[model samples]
Target: MTHLVMDVDTGIDDSLALLYLLGDSRAQLEAIVCTAGNVPARQVADNTLGWLALAGAGAIEVALGAEVPLSQPLQTTEDTHGPLGVGYAELPPHGRTISGRHAASVWSEAARSHPGEVTGLVTGPLTNLALAVQLDPELPQLLGRLVVMGGALNHPGNTRPTVEWNTAVDPDAAKIVFDRFAGLPAERRPILCPLDLTERIVMTSAHVERLAAASGCAAPERILPSDDRGRRSSADVELIRQLSDAIRFYMEFHRDMGQGFIAHMHDPFAAAVALDPGRAQYRPATLDVELAGRLTRGQIVADWPGPSGAGIWGRPPNADVAADTDPEAFFDALIERIAAVALDGPAR
Candidate 1:
């Protein structure tokens, strides 16, 4: 099994990513470190605990990290994830408490404990990981893998004209992380699942229907009320209902954005790639975050080697940037996983 440490902001997509990891038999989730991104740190922590409770995986360790970005003020995407960060999905109160340790400590300790056996997946801002790197400069070399869901690269940003939400929210931390991992061996460098590739794995209403059908639950449209208090249902069915309700607002947001009622499987795709890098195609590049330009700050610039085999600053490739994904294969595996999770009753 692949030992995993996930750092998240507990947004709608983040919740889905958590479920994917928790349900996957191949993953051994070491810890979940909450950070501020799509929501404040407190809400993120609460949401993380609540979601784990809903999954019946309350035993998982959770720790709170940075309350805000390294330098910039905290800016949440409540507009995208709804006020509670999970849209309309209301989970039961978390029965478990967070770990006494902070997120940075949890990350550092986990990395040191597992050595080159832990895969770190960050679906929120880079604040927590950056601090962990600061505490342990050798963290990049110790981790088996580091998969991140941020940046836009050649694609237009979702939050800004030139910046992705996660990186833009904490460019300083992002720069630190990219620079810190730059010296690692090619095989050990971070793998970036940017918006450029994530946007390609769109989850539409049809896909939701398929998941519901495969899981033996009512279709999303047929599941009226869409809230926990709506009606009585089996535990397995309720799981699907909760997921559908959580993404309702997100789907509408995509519709309003003219994306046709489809939500990008951003964070989950990062988790999937972390679990298995062969799911997507990657290109080696030297990446740097732009931090000085008013209009360009947080933009991830890639230095692709030319015919002369020379990068912009002659910097060696430090990251494997995802360029393409087989959407059919990806969605197939994703739906299968969700269905299996639903049929299994609940997370252990």
Candidate 2:
């Protein structure tokens, strides 16, 4: 079984990543440290609790992390993730309240308690982890593995012309984590899933239909465009209905952005890579985040023998950058795992 401590922004994609783990029996989610990225920090904690309630995940600890970036004002992507961060889905908060501990404390405590057994997964800005590292400098070596979903490594950016969303949210934190982890051994290096790798894990209306069907919803999940509106999913299962509504908004957003009617499943793909190291073809490189370019700030540079994920400046590679991943394999596991959550089935 894999023991995981997560730091997330609880956006639509982050919600899907959480569901993937909730359904997978092997993933023992130890705690969740919420940060402000997709939405406010407090809202992210509530969203995390709501998902736990929806999935009937045991009383996992949920803690609030950084309320803002290291040195910048907080900026949330409400347009991309909706006001509450779960797209159109309204997940009711459960009886569980936020942990009394701060996110940095929770981070240090979780890893220190578990030692080499904890896999640290950060699906949002690195602010929380960066703060945690400040509290505990040993955090990098303490974590057995780390999987991060951010950056635009040698690719076009999603937030700006040269930056990805998460890194753009807090480039300073990203820089700190990369620099701190640089000293770790290669085997213990974090897996970096930049946009160059994650953009390939796209989700379409058909994949939603398949996921609904796998969860025993017979409704045809279709998203059409015309002077006449398209038919949306009316799946009876609560989980299916919620996900359908959420993904439909995501698809619309992508379509409006001219990326077709698709949502980039970045976070869940990172979750999969965390569970299985070989799920993606990785290239080790020295990775760093740009902090001072007027046009290029927040851009992550991965130096291979020459550019950067897995090295640069005469330093050895500090990250195992995911250069490629099999989309079909990921979708297979995603559908099956999330389907199991809807069914409340035994973890596979």
Candidate 3:
């Protein structure tokens, strides 16, 4: 089994990523570290616990991380994820409490306990991981891999003209993480699933209809609502209902963006690549975060070699950046994993 420690902001896609991990039989979720990105830190913690309960994954430990970025005030995206971050889905309050320790401490503890067996899947701001790296300099070497779902790479940014939300929210932390990982050996470098690749793993309304149908829930017409309110009642399986409700706002946001009624599976794609690296194609590149420019701040500059087979500006490759993904295969794997969860109930 692939042991994972996920760091999330517990928004729409983050919730989907959590469910995907919980449903995949090969994934052994060691812990979930909630950070501030898509929502507030406390609300992210609450959303994490609620998702755990919905997935019946209460056994997994949950911890709260930084409430604000290392150098900036907290910026939330409630407009995209609704007021509570999980759209219209109203999950019951979890009886289990978050770990008393901070998120960095939780990361250190998990790494020390699991040693080289753990894989860190971060789908939010890099503040927690950066702090964890500071607390334990050996953290990069302790994990088997670090799959991050941020950065725009060769593609345009989703948050600004040149910045993605996660990295833009905390460019300092992003710089720290990239620099630390770049210093590591090539084999130990983190894998980046940026917008260039994640945009390829889009989930349209048709796919949602298929997933809802596969869950043995009511038909799409019965479960999906036309507006943001979503369905008033739950489905046969709680997971299906939660997923359906959670994606409503996300889909609406995509529609508003003129991207159709489809949401990019950014976090979930990162989670998938963490579980199986072969799911997407990758290219080694030297990555650096732009922290100085007012317009380019938080932009990830990937330096690819010239035709002469020499490094660009003498910068050696640092990380493996995802170039593309097989959409059909990715969707198939996602569907199968969710279907397994629906059939077998929440993992553990």
Candidate that beats the other on TM-score, 1 or 2, i.e. the better one: 2
Estimated TM-score per prediction?
0.94, 0.95, 0.95
How far out, in Å, is residue 337 in model 3? 1.4
TM-score head-to-head 1 vs 3, winner = 3
Q: Per-residue lDDT for 128-218 in model 3, tens only?
A: 9999999999888898889999999878998888788899889999999988876667776789999988888888767776787787776
| Candidate 3 weakest lDDT stretch, 10 residues | 221-230
Residue runs of model 2 more than 4 Å from their true location after superposition: 226-232, 306-312, 345-348
Candidate 1 error regions (>4 Å): 218-236, 345-348
Predicted candidate 2 versus true structure: per-residue lDDT over 1-348, tens digit per residue: 998998999999998999998888889888899999999999999988988887777778899989999998889998888778877787765788899999999888888998988999999999999999999999888899999999887889999997999999999999999998887777899999999989999998779878988998866656554413223456788887888777877777787789988999999999988888889998888888899999888899987865432134777888989998789889999999999999974363
Give me the candidate number with maximum TM-score. Answer: 2
Candidate 2 RMSD computed on C-alpha atoms after optimal superposition onto the true structure: 2.2
lDDT of 2 at 26: 85
Q: Which residue ranges in model 3 land beyond 4 Å of their true spot?
A: 218-234
Residue pairs with backbone overlap in model 3: none
Question: Model 1 scores what on Cα lDDT?
Answer: 0.85
How does model 3 fare in lDDT? Answer: 0.84
lDDT by residue (1-348, candidate 1, tens digit) is 899999999999998898888778888899999999998988898998987776666478899999989998889989889898987778777678888899999988998999999999999999999999999898888898899999988889998897999998899999999999987877888999999999998887677777888888743433332333323333358778788877777876776688876788899899999999999899888899999998989898889888777688898888999998899788887788777777783444
